[model samples]
Target: MGDWLRLTYFNGSLWRRFLIDYLFGIVVNNICAVVVAFVILPGDPFFHCWVFSMCIGSLVMWMADGCRILIWQGGRPSLPGLLGIFVVTIPVGYFGGSYLAAKLLALPVEAVLNRQIEHASPLLIMILIVCVFFAWFNWSQSELSELRAKAETEKAHMAAVERQAMQAQLQLLQAQIEPHMLFNTLANLQGLIALDAPRAQYMLDKLIHYLRASLSSSRAETTTLAHEFELMHAYLELMSVRMGARLTYSLTLPPELERFAIPPMLLQPLVENAIKHGLESKIEGGRVEVVAKRDDKRLKISVADDGLGLETGNGVHYPNHGTGLGVANVRERLRALHGDAASLTLEPNTPQGAIATLTLPYEP
Candidate 1:
């Protein structure tokens, strides 16, 4: 009784369910009205059938909803339960509609109710057809909703797998870089140890400082721009010890941009490329500058070196010239992380050297 009186239906908004069901009832009832007037009860007026259908349909739909809410908790009921609800509700709807129509026309209730008794089989057949149609419609909608939910779950799983795979590839690329940088630094240190004892000790000390600063960020997936620049400063200081006056470097990070987050070791490889391919090749090695600035909504960082401006061959700037593994690593990482939103471009710096500029969507 409480369920029948309750405003809510099918775990949805009461008014929304009512409006939708009422609209569906109108459509279904009109179809049934046409069938009854033309085929089931020949010579019967279409207007009379339509009015009775409208009244019966409205009452039947309301009762069916109440039965579903009570017995099945508003979900689609079992086949037997569905049949029982229809059998009980259809007869009640027909009798109630008969009573209402009799009152409206000021006619005798017995005359109106007894009119359909002789054609009981046809009336029962019509009710059965409506019950089957409603059952099929409900089942199809439930199936479609389940399929849609399943598709969404599968899509989310695929995204998670793709993210994990990309992370693994990035880790492999980062691993390659650390060893390359370490080997070169160690090789230089070994040479200095034999030739100059004091400078070797100083280089070793600087190397320790650089490694200490890098350890934390190296293991992380992301780091702040300020931390990245600090690592670069330590790296440049270590290199300065080796090259003395030959290697001069500057890292410029605006205060506002310092807290922007980026993948770890993103700039390190760019800095390494500038030193190895650009400055180290020149007799009097020139400056390497790393500058970070905002280009509207994007973050742009450039590593520029004024040494042996890209070796031009056949009018091409970079291909014939030594770009190295660092360039490839940086490009792969950016692609995996930001897709088309991030890019790395190498162009000749004015008058001398090459500039590798990294552009990425700013994320804080």
Candidate 2:
């Protein structure tokens, strides 16, 4: 029943739409009758024989409207097509209704048609004028709808292009950061190998594992939260070996959100920033907590550290001249992916640390 109603009213079945058009034509014909009696044929007054004539006219108009709707529905609603239907149908309907009315009124068909032509020409002219305006209105609306659809298609195409550009920019940034991290780790390994071979070997094995996972993740545009967490865990473990008891870390991921997708390497830079600016600066190092949870319609991932808080004037000051390239990269990528719907915030954690919190739309 709901579907039937939708067909009658909405952009559904063409037959149902034609039925609505037919009904509207009947109303229009009656309104024309009122106008004819009041203004065009005041002496005749639309009574008796005139009412019968109008009824027959309404039926003819309804059939004409139905034919027009069917032709338009067949996808050839051009001006020429509409004009053709109108030219062929209008005279046939007018003359046929005149014949029917004459027969019902016990008059000669020729006499009735001649009388119609003489007296009711205004009503016929009004109907033709209304039909022309209706055709023009439909043509204008069709043009507007096509223009709107074309605009939407262009908008989507531009959005896709922008997304691709952002992805390319992110990949370039990752490429730059990855080699820097690798060179630093290798430099550290070179010194460690001379001083302590066993610790060096352990770090090497961790590096191998981290590199393998990172390579696999880099090949994909997106990764699951679980996989992202796994990569972060491997990185933190590698850092743990380097820092020993000086660096401690914890990872908490809810099982329900394990499958949530995020851009590859999104969280690692946050973790690296924490360790570099926060933990590495402190004398006793610090504990780093990486927590992931669902917050309303958003997924919140926070990287917090118990290290020296941000300097009074400078916010979350970094050790190496404070470029903040990693944080900026993450922010740009988030903007590209979710527009204004995602955010990354850097705030002071309680007591003595800095926290980087990332919030994005969550799809379950």
Candidate 3:
């Protein structure tokens, strides 16, 4: 009952809404009083006739408005349904109001009915005009409301579709990236087995651990920066086993920023590219630093290495070797997820070697 009342009254305020209807009734009554005074009851005392017209007109308008509300509660009406309602309710309201007004005015019911019959044509025309206007008003309002609701529903559905597409694309990219890294690691293990059996065994163990964690995370759409860093840490450890003392790496992440979410497998490619093009080429090899920091509302992550820089003109460098497939994949994923709000850049590290930096919005 409460819910129905709330729906029936504007803004869920029944008394306030009723007051508005009362005000509307007053306005309509005044208009009817003017018409009655100048045309229908010209010979009657102006004040008395005006008062009588107010009583009848106000009652009729109120009842008509109530009937309109009731009809609309059942949903938008058909044209025939609307016409039927107006036909039944309007005349009923008119006759009931007129009978009551005649009694209050100390006039005979026959006298009032006779006067109304004499002015029947003009009165009928006026009633027809009022009915047409109100009917058109109701119809237009219902159509506009329906259009707005349809638009909102479509907007929500489109948003859901876009999200699904993004997840599917991310999964496809991850699938490609996983095999590339796995093949490269296996190749390195094959070479190390012949040169250093004990080191190869250690690298195999690390590879197993890395694969278990990475494979699980890759199945997910996103992971925290801390988890991605852990995967990278395992990969670097595997590399260390292969390179011995020649390769060194560091990973730094603030405790507060660790919870920020990023696409899974996002950072590992940058680390791999650094090792393949930067440290591996240097005879003595060098250090790689993976650092993540907060930059206002954004996150800044960089993979920096101290090795043979871009000056070496290494063809193996990203976008240069097979069009930097791995790097390009990373950039494409970032663009899809964040649009223009995220970016990946490669530049020379301060002293030597390449630095790959990624900047993206920090979503918690």
Clashes of each: 1, 0, 2
Per-candidate TM-score against the hidden true structure: 0.76, 0.74, 0.77
Residue runs of model 1 more than 4 Å from their true location after superposition: 1-22, 33-55, 62-81, 84-124, 194-205, 312-322, 362-364
Span of ten consecutive residues with least summed lDDT in model 2: 314-323
The superposed Cα distance between candidate 2 and the true structure at residue 217, in angstroms, equals 3.9
Show the colliding residue pairs in model 3.
309-353, 319-324
What are the per-residue Cα lDDT tens digits for candidate 1 across 129-212?
786786677667556656876998999999999988988999999998999999999999999999999999999999999999
Candidate 3 residue runs with Cα over 4 Å from true position:
1-74, 95-125, 313-323
Winner by lDDT between candidate 3 and candidate 1: 1
Candidates 1 and 3 compared: the better one by TM-score is 3
lDDT of 2: 0.77
Ten contiguous residues minimizing lDDT sum, candidate 1: 5-14
- Looking at model 2, residue 24 earns an lDDT score of 61
The residue pairs in collision within model 2 are: none
